[model samples]
Structure formats: C-alpha cells, structure tokens
Target: EPEVTQTPSHQVTQMGQEVILRCVPISNHLYFYWYRQILGQKVEFLVSFYNNEISEKSEIFDDQFSVERPDGSNFTLKIRSTKLEDSAMYFCASRTGLNTEAFFGQGTRLTVV
Candidate 1:
C-alpha cells in the first residue's frame, strides 16, 4: 500500500532559525494535514489542506508556520523561526476522503535549542 513519506527522520536546529520539513503524501489522497506531538503529548492538529487551499487550521498554526503543495505530490510545512517549544515529531497525514482512514508519515523529529 502507498504511504506518506517524510524526509530527514531527525533534524536539529537552533532557535530563531528556519526549517522546512518535507513530505510526499499518497498520490491519490485528497486531503492533507500536518500534526505534531510534543514528546509525550497527544498529537495536535496544525492545519488541513484541500484543493490547494487551507480548509482549516488550529490556533497552533500561527503565522510562523506555513504549508504548501509546491507540486502535485509534495506537501511541505515550513517553520519560519524555530522555538525550543517547537521540538517534537511532526507528522504528515493524508486521506482519500473525510471518513477514510488517514495514512501518516514516519514523522520528522525536530529538536530546537
């Protein structure tokens, strides 16, 4: 079965720096989302995109964060200025439809200092 794939299994960056996490979501999936887990915390939604536009976003997805489908198959999340609190596993998820099961990437672990 096809699955979402994330680049750089781990990343370490300094605070105030910028980072762009990349993901290649399932080709046929229509909905794409970004979620994060802060070490031991539950996964929190960041943003959802469909039809090349943001469908919904959580308050956590502030101006500092952005998502884009730079191409037909790539979904990416960029953190403008990294923060120590941003350290966590960021997951890329995609589903064929609202009710369909979502496929998640292995995740990119970001550690900011």
Candidate 2:
C-alpha cells in the first residue's frame, strides 16, 4: 500500500537552530496534516492543508512553524527556530477525503537541546 514517507527519521539540533521536517504524503490524497507527540503525550494536531492553502491550524502552530507542499509530491514542516520544548515526534498524515481513514508516516523524532 502507498504510505506517507518522512526523511531523517531522527534529528538533533541546538535550541536556536532551524529545522525542516520533510514528508511525501500518499500521492492521491487531497488533504494533509502535521501532528506532533511530545515524549509521552497524546498526539496533537498542528495544522491542515488543502487546495494548496492552509485550511486550519491549532494554537500550538505559531509563527515559528510553517507547512508547505512546495511541489506536487512533497510536503514539509519548518520550524524557524528550535526550542527545547519543541522536542517531539513529528508525524505527517493524509486522507483521501472527509470521513476516510488518515494514513500517518513513521514520524521524525526531533531532539532539541
């Protein structure tokens, strides 16, 4: 089955550095989302994108974070500046449409020191 794919499964960076988490969602899915899980916490939604625009975003998704499709095949999430609190596992997900199952990538583990 086609699945979402993320790069650099593990990333470690300094507190003030910038990082870009990349993903390639299922080719045919129309809706895409970025989610994060802090160490032991439950998953949290960060943002959703569709039709080449942001459809919705959570309060956790501040100006420091941004998402983009950049091209037909790749989706990305960028953190302007990393913070210790930003350490978490970032996941990329997608669904074909409303009411359908959303598939998630294996996730990128980010360690901000």
Candidate 3:
C-alpha cells in the first residue's frame, strides 16, 4: 500500500532557527493536513490544504508557519521562526474524504533548544 513518508525521524534545532518538516502523502489522496502533539498534550490541528491552497488552518498555524506542495509527491511545512514551544511531534496526514480516515506519517519529532 502507498503510504505517507516523513523525513528525519527526529530533528534538533536552535530556538530561533528555521526548520522544514517534510512528507510525501499517499497517492490518489486529495486533502493534506498538519497536526502536532506536545509531549503529553492532545493532538492539535495546524492546517489543511486542498487543491494547492489552504482549506483550513487552526490558530496554532500563526505567521511563522507555511505549507507547500513543491512537486507531484512532496509536501512540506516550514517554520520561519522556531520557538521552544514548537518542540513537538509534527504529523503529516492525508485523506480522500472531507471527513474521514487520515493516514499519518509516523511523525517528525522536532526539538527546539
């Protein structure tokens, strides 16, 4: 089965640097989303994109964040300015339905110091 793939299983960055988390969503899927979970906190939605534009975004997706599909298979989330609070497991997901099962990439653990 085709699956979403995220790189750098873990990332360590300085508090003020930029970081780009990457993913390759499942083929034939239409919607893409980004969600994160603090060490022990609930999973929070960051943003969702469809047809190359943002479909929805949560408050957590502030000015510092952006998403893009640079190629037929690659999707990425870039944090312009990282913060200590940004340390979390960032998950990339994709689903075909507007509201349905989202296949999650294992996750890219980002740690800001």
- What TM-score do all the candidates reach, one by one? 0.98, 0.98, 0.97
Which ranges of candidate 2 are over 4 A from the true structure?
Answer: none
Question: Mind giving the per-residue lDDT tens digits that candidate 3 earns over 35-110?
Answer: 9999999999999999999999999999999999999688999999999999999999999887779999999999
23-61, model 1: which lDDT tens digit per residue? 999999999999999998999999999999999999999
Worst 10 residues of 1 by lDDT: 1-10
In model 3, the Cα lDDT at residue 67 comes to 97
Residue 100 alpha-carbon offset, candidate 3, angstroms:
3.5
lDDT score of model 1? 0.97
lDDT scores for all predictions?
0.97, 0.96, 0.95
| Model 1, residue 39: C-alpha shift (Å) | 0.7
Instruction: Return whichever of 2 and 3 wins on lDDT.
Output: 2
Q: By lDDT, highest first, what's the ranking? A: 1, 2, 3
